[model samples]
Target: MLSLPATLTQDHARECLEQLTDGLQAEAAQVVVDAAELRQFDSSALAVLLALRRECARAGKHFAVQGLPQRLRDLATLYGIEGLLPAA
Candidate 1:
């Protein structure tokens, strides 16, 4: 599982994304992104997940999110990206 840090703001998007990518590249099972700690996020934070999903697809791997906060769920829907972060 991709455990998110205490926060997921724009300040750490790149660094966190890199760490996530590293974990993805080394994992044998499906990449499960854990977002339980992502309390508040903006467009940049959203981009990080989108980019990771793209990278996973490019490398032919399964990707799904875990513990997504309601704020994020609403953001995805508001931005027309709910399809990317389906329930569960």
Candidate 2:
């Protein structure tokens, strides 16, 4: 399981993505991201997740997220991309 940072904004998007991507390489067929610690964040957080989801797909792995905050879920719904981030 991979964990998200407490704060994930546009400023940290790139670095966070790199770190998560590296972590993904060591995961099994199922990739579960724990987002409960995420507090301060922006849409970039979703961007990172989406990128990670794509990366998982490319690697033929299953992807899911856990502990997604309601606000973030709302954001994803508003963007009409909630389906991309499956819950664990």
User: Against the unseen true structure, what C-alpha lDDT does each candidate score?
Assistant: 0.81, 0.99
- Per-residue CA lDDT of model 2 for 1-88, tens digit only, reads 9999999999999999999999999999999999999999999999999999999999999999999999999999999999999999
13 Cα displacement, candidate 2 (Å): 0.4
Candidate 1 local lDDT, residue 60 = 88
lDDT for position 55 in model 2:
99
- Clashes per candidate (backbone, < 3 Å): 0, 0
- Cand. 2 TM to true fold: 0.99
Q: Encode model 1's per-residue lDDT on 1-88: one tens digit a residue.
A: 7777767788889998999888888865477888888776776777888888888888888788888888878888899997886443
Clashing pairs in 2: none
Candidate 1: regions farther than 4 A off? none
Instruction: Indicate which candidate wins on lDDT.
Output: 2
| RMSD (CA, Å), each prediction | 1.4, 0.3
